[model samples]
Target: MIIGVALGMMAALLAAVEVTATVRPDVVIGLVIGVPGVLGMLMILMSSRRWVTAVGAMILAIGPGWFGALTAIQVASGV
Candidate 1:
């Protein structure tokens, strides 16, 4: 769990850096998706209860989906 948390934090940081470095909206979108995924994973690792872990996993899955959908809408709308 500790290892998972560490990896998740590291990945989130990396994704944040990537998002900052790029201008292409798609890569930014991906980074946006990734950051929350990592954070959710970290939450799962930190929590002791199975229910909390399950909720975290659900958040992890949903965050990226929201990001992707928002990105697609933005692209389609030329935002």
Candidate 2:
């Protein structure tokens, strides 16, 4: 839980910085997706309830999973 919170906070901070400084839209988007994903993944890890796990998994897929896919595509395409 602590680790998850820390990672989420860090991602938020990074997004804030990107918004204020570079303002690169794509990076900001990825960070936005990642923050909640980290928390959702943490919740999934810590919970035993099936519904909670399912919700977390959905959030995880939409958030960091998509973010990772985008990043990989960008890297592969040299963009």
Candidate 3:
């Protein structure tokens, strides 16, 4: 559960960085998205409990869009 949370957080940060780098080519989106995703998948793969693996997969699937909505809200409110 803890590893899932950490990976989810890392994924969120990577996604945010990817969005930020869209206007600037200096930042590499592939690297940002790939590394954490790979680590998260590895962690999920290593989990012995099926529930843990499911939760991690779900978190990886959902965390990005949820954080993206929050980020959108913040940007809209500022504008």
C-alpha-based local distance difference test score of model 2:
0.60
| Model 2 agreement with the true structure over 1-79: per-residue lDDT tens digits | 3433344455544544454454575666756686677877897998889988876766565554444444554577686
After superposition, the stretches of candidate 1 with alpha carbons farther than 4 Å from their true spots are 1-27
Question: What clash pairs does model 1 have?
Answer: none
The residue-level lDDT of candidate 1 at 11 comes to: 53
Decide which is better by TM-score, 1 or 3.
Answer: 1
Q: Each model's TM-score? A: 0.49, 0.44, 0.38
Off by over 4 Å in 3: 1-39
Better structure of 2 and 3 per TM-score: 2
Task: Assess each prediction's global lDDT (C-alpha) against the native.
Answer: 0.63, 0.60, 0.56
Per residue, candidate 1 scores C-alpha lDDT tens digits across 5-41 of 4444555455544554536866756666676688788
TM-score of 3: 0.38
Worst 10 residues of 3 by lDDT: 21-30
| Candidate 2 segments exceeding 4 Å error | 1-22, 26-30, 64-79
Tens-place lDDT per residue, model 3, 1-79, is 4454455566656655576543342233344445546655876988899886776575554444444444564587683
